[model samples]
Target chain A: MVAISDLKKISEYEWEIPQSFRADMRVPVRFFVTRDLLEQALRDASLEQAVNAATLPGLVGHVTVMPDMHQGYGFPIGGVAATRYPQGVISPGAIGYDINCGVRLLGSQIEAEAAKPRLDVLATALNKYCPSGVGQGGALKLTERELDAICVEGAEWAKKRGYASDADLRRTEEGGRLEGADPAKVSPRAKQRGRPQIGTLGAGNHFIEVDVVEEIFDEEAAQVMGLHAGHLALQIHCGSRGFGHQICSDYVRAFQGAVKRYGIQLPDRELVCAPLDSPEGQDYLAAMRCAANYAFANRQLLAHWARQAFEETLAGGVKNWHLHQIYDIAHNMGKVEEHVVDGKKLKVCVHRKGATRAFGPGFPGLPAEYQKIGQPVLVPGSMGTASWVLVGTEGSMQRSFGSTCHGAGRTMSRSQAKKQIWGEDLRKELEGEGIHIRTGSLAGLAEEAPAAYKDVDAVVETVTGAGIARKVARLVPLVVVKG
Target chain B: MFTLTTTYQRNYKGSVTWGVGCDFQLEVLPFFVGIGKIRYTGKTMVTETGYREIEHTADWELEVWAPNLSSLLETAARGMYALAQMQLVDGERESREFEIPFGDRESLLVDFLAELLYLGEGEGLVMDEFSFTFDGNTLKVRAWGAPIKNQSKEIKAVTYHRLQIRETEFGLVVNLVFDV
Candidate 1:
């Protein structure tokens, strides 16, 4: 177990566990969390997992963990680790099973007061249009050839099918399509799973939430993103579904031997990895890109359907019901990029499991309008809580490798949450608070109760306090659809 | 030839019997059961194999114990089904058979459960009766079950996180984590 005494406090919201803490660790571990959050994190194995992640070969700088960190399977959920490109190792487990699991925020001009009456109808329409729940297939069933095309093209494939607009692609990370996706590297079983799940919002912490922008901290930044206080916005959170899961599983299993063949030793088997330049690593990277593209396209299709739902519910009843893309950012991914490390520029693969890429202003990737305002970072709170919209800072680029917290990380186990909270009663309580709820299973809702997660406001405060991210707006959920 | 009389109940602490080779009685208790201990009474005996859930913040972890690898896999499968709250409707029954190449004990366990997850999600099927045959380097399995009537939760994939099959004083013990 990792203790607070093992850490050297850098600031009020930052701490470091030096490499000397463990002989096997190649680099140190840096944490961006408040004292309270850090104390809470000590009760779990998240910090230990972060320390374990520091042992990956060719790790540069340090392993960075966000304030909303929680214990995940192999890697801590809010972890970000960057390794030297070409020779450094990349673990499939570090990127997570849900490749490119991300959040997409859509802003609209529809005022909360005007949309209040139709909120229930809008929620129902969103649920009806978006295919969700366990083992739920989407409307479109693609052929093998079509699936391959999607693997390579990503959200562009959706755009060709009239599911996305130009601005939507521009505002999305990597233009909604990651480069270097090779379908041939992906397994047939993965393709089979991907065929019918292209546009699905899979169960387990994935949701489509409608929120009202209650407060704006950065007025100019909010305006540039088309976010208006008291206006309606929608958030879609999901990932590559079974396709990514199979790809990750296949590689994690295959890498069990890869580690042996490469003669790399690690404390945990789940941290199995290979050199970034090795054939095995390249193959996994190629397959992982396919899943990432699939997820981008997945969110795009859902956004299209969400737009249709909005049109259906508020077409004639309200004026300006259009929902424009604010920003779409992936929280789980491995991206190859150039960053300054040890006073030198180096290309590295940044593996962010449950952390978002928060590129500061002046990066060329941002849309022209957002060049002065930095990349948008979406931090969704637990159900019936306040979600946040933030932007990257130079501090993030220098210290945390351009990453921030993903969401309000879970503090309680699912079983404990289920044992403590009744889903039906929680639903009644949320409805009483005027939040419309649509779900396939009440048990799932119970597991995701607000009490199960840390406070989102506090998580955001830590990041902003640490100067890694800047708050732009705060959103309060009005309707939540979970699967 | 063994006559397997299997009965599946959906009630809390549902019990099922897997009569394999001998007149064996099986029960699914709400909590973890001990390793197999043979107690003969005339011509009938009881076999114990069980799994229990472990606390994990973001995912599901299960600890299973059995007398052998095959029984451990079966108990883990049943435990996974129970975790998902899967229920099968009464109607026509279906049997499916498949083979998995034996690599290591942990890989085999993950592959077996992943195959079951694929079947449950892709074909809407769940297996109750399982027969295992271990060859030189492969595991052949024949399973019987029906379409799923309802499932309350979804498990995304079986993870290899801290997965190790151990030989204990009582039997073979293993811990599995599922990304839900």
Candidate 2:
């Protein structure tokens, strides 16, 4: 176990564990966290896992962990690592099982005061339109050929089918489609799983939330993002479902042998990896991209259904019920990009497991209107807590690998939460607070209790204080649909 | 009913004995470790295999133990089903038979569970009766169950994090972490 004495304090919001802490580590581990959050992280194995991640071969700079860090399977949640391109390795476990699991925010002009009366109807419509729960398939059953198309085309495929608009594509990360997605690389079993699960909000921490913009910190940035205080906004959180899970499982299993063949030694088997130049590495990357694209299309389809739900509930009753896309950002992904490392521009693969890419202002990838500002960073809180909207900063590019915290990380185990909190009681409490709740399983609700996670506001304060991200707006949930 | 007939007997403490006949086996050992501990009652009529949940902040961890690899696999499957709150409806029994090319013990364990997860999610099947035959470099499994009636949560994948099948004094013990 790592203690606070092992760390070198850099600032109030920053700390470092030097490479000397472990002989096997190739690089140091940098932490963007408040002292309180760091103490919370020490209570778990997250810091130790981050230390293990630092042992990956060909790692550049340092392994960066966000303030909302928690213990994940192999890699710590809220971890970011950049490896030298072409020769460096990519670990499937580092990118996570839910490939491209992300958040999409949609802003609308519908005022919360005017829509209060029909909030329940809107919640019901959202639940009815969006298929959720364990093993729930979406409305569309695509053929193998169409599934292949979705693999390559991503949200563009949805746009062609009238599920997305042009602006929706532009505002999404990587335009909601990752290039070089090869369906041939994905396993047949993965394709079979992907066929029916597209456009679904599968269970376990995935939710579609209706929120009212509670406060605006950056007025200009909020206006550019079409976010208005006291207005309604929707947040969709999900991923590629079983398709991605199977793909990740297939590769993780395959890489267990790859690590042996390449003679790469690691402390943890789950941190298995292959050199980017290897055939195994290339195939996994291709398959992973397919899953990422599938997720983009999945969220796009959900957004379309959410729009219909809004229209159905408030079409004639409200004047402007349209929900425009704010931004869709993926927290779990591996991308090949150029970044300044050691004052030199180097191409690297940034593996962000539970961290969002927070590219600073003037990055070429941002949409035209967001070029002056930065890419939007969506940090969802636990259910019934305040979610935040932040933007990238230049400090993020210099210190970290252009990444920020993903959400309010879990502090309590599911079993513990379930034991301590009752789902019925939580539901009644939230409903009493005027938050509409729709869910399939109350047990799942108990597992996701707000007490299970850290405070989101404190997490945001740490990041903004560290100058890695700037807060734009705060959102309070009014309706939450969980699977 | 899956008939279980006694095949072996043991009198030593901490020794594992098995009653095997039909699709399932009744494993008896002196003592069980981890979650639900089963004590030696001297009569050898109760199950010794068991699993229990461990505290993990972001995912599920299960500590499972049994007399052998086959019993360990079955117990782990039961633990996973319990974690997901999966229930099967009363109906005609369905069975699935398949072979997994064995690499290592850990890989085989993961592959076996992954296969079960696929079946549960894709085919809506949950197996309670399991028979395993280990040949040269291969594992043949026959599982019997009914269609799933309800499942509260979904486990995204079974992870290889710190997965090691250890030989204990009593039996085999392993810790499995699941991505939920």
Candidate 3:
């Protein structure tokens, strides 16, 4: 645990744990948090995890944790680390168990008021049309060969199948496919876990919510994202599901000895890693990409289901009920890219766990349509809370390695939340707030009560104030489905 | 009645465990670890009884059982080592044992395994097995793992949040989520 007084304040919103704090640490640990939130964060093991991450081999740039950060297995949920690409190491633990668990948002022409009565119907239709809530399978059950195609093709595969549009591919990070995804690198067991889950919304913290575009911060950017005040939009929060989870689990175990083989020393076993250019590192990277692609394909399929639900519910009332894919971005992943560190443009693999990619405008990877607006960064709040859509900024490049907070980080444990709140009562509370929810269990609902998380507004404010991302729109949830 | 469906795609074949807790076995790792679904029958709800033990496979023996998915998952955590006959000595037994209460079944599965790994790794306590009872949102779990002479795998931390645990007449089912 870090003593609050030991922190060296960088500003009102940032604090630093310098290298001198520990002998094994290769770099200092930086945290972006408000004064109050920082105090709350100190009560958990997340700070220790961040400090431990600083000790991993090949780590470049200071280790950083976002305000929404919370305790995770090896690294803090909102942790970020960059290692030299070829010589540095890749640790599955840094990426997390649910690999490529990300967020995707779609914009529609329909208005919230116009779709009010249909909200419930659409929710039910979506629940039926799109398999959700624990162990649900997708509409398309891929053969081994087809699953391989998905691992390699990603959202492009969806595009070919008419599930995704060209524009949709254009807006996704890495165009919905991370390069170097070798199907051979992914274990057969991991593949098996992903095979049936494609296009399915696997449970836990994964949700598809209906939102009303309540406010727009940047008019031009909002226009590019197809967001309009009072318009209805759909946000899907899920990822590679069992496929990604299995990949991470498989690799973390595989890398257990790699850390020692590479002569790397880590504070936590969960932080095990291997050099990027090494055989083990390459294998993990390839598998990571496979999981990432699987996630893109998974979200694309869910988008299809959402479209079908809207069409079935609206039934000729709204034409072109297709939910236009605004953008899909990954928060938990490792990407090999070139970034200027200490004035040298070195290729490094950036590991973002529970943090979103906020690439500024003019990056080569973006679609032609969004070149001027920057990458869309989606930050979801907990159940019955406000979610925001933001865009990357130039300041991010200079500081956070083009990263921002992912969501309202956890403020309490599930047990803590459950002990304090009743699932039925919480449901009533959210309903009173006009947010409709469909869940597998009432007890589960109470654990996700909005109070269990930090104020997303404060977390978003820190990043926006830090210039890592500029808020574009705030989405108020109308309906939520949980697993 | 919780219904479970398994789909095999490409090289990937997985199952979704949902519905009452009948799919609890799916929540247990090295047993049925994957995706699957369960739907409540809205019919007869009976008294749920369960049992857990480590089963020996051809190569590796693992803790196995059904305890309404959540408890089964929690037991699986201890089962992983108890199958190896590890015991959590009285001296090493945790005074304040870690419990990861999941909101739903999915997160509960993951959280249960994660807790096992966490206890084994963070505290260096080798647990054998655990029993559980659910009270609304709270999952009361008592886990046991014997101390190992030499440890091979170190379990890390456990998470709840999206963690899942469920109950059904098919014999209590749960998913064990590990951060291994």
Q: Best candidate per DockQ, number?
A: 2
Going through the candidates in order, what is chain B's TM-score?
0.75, 0.74, 0.43
lDDT (tens digit, per residue) of candidate 2 on B77-171: 88788777677888899999989999999999999999999999889999889999999999999999989977877999999999999996658
Query: After superposing candidate 2, which stretches have Cα over 4 Å from the reference?
Result: B1-47
| lDDT by residue for model 2 (A1-483), tens | 899999999999999999999999999999988878988999999999999999999899999999999999889999999999989999999999999999999999999999999999999999999999999999999999999999999999999999999999999999999998899999999998899999999999999999999999999999999999999999999999999999999999999999999999998999999999899999999999999999999999999999999999999988999999999999999999899999999999999999999999999799999988899999999999999999999999998889999999999988778767778899999999999999998888888999999999999999999999999999999999999
iRMS of candidate 3, one decimal?
A: 14.7
DockQ of each: 0.42, 0.44, 0.05
The Cα error of candidate 2 at residue A269, in Å, is 0.8
**Candidate 2 chain A weakest lDDT stretch, 10 residues:** A415-424
- The true-versus-predicted C-alpha distance at residue A360 of model 3, in Å, is 1.1
Q: Write the per-residue lDDT of candidate 1 for residues A324-388, one digit (tens) a residue.
A: 99999999999999898999999999999999999999976888988899999999999999999
True contacts kept of each: 0.81, 0.88, 0.04
Give DockQ: model 2: 0.44
Model 1, backbone clash pairs (residues 3+ apart or across chains), number = 0
DockQ of candidate 1 compared with the true complex: 0.42
Each model's RMSD to truth, in Å? 5.7, 6.0, 13.7
Q: How do all the candidates rank in terms of lDDT, highest first?
A: 2, 1, 3
lDDT pick, better of 2 and 3: 2
Model 3 stretches with alpha carbons more than 4 Å out = B1-180
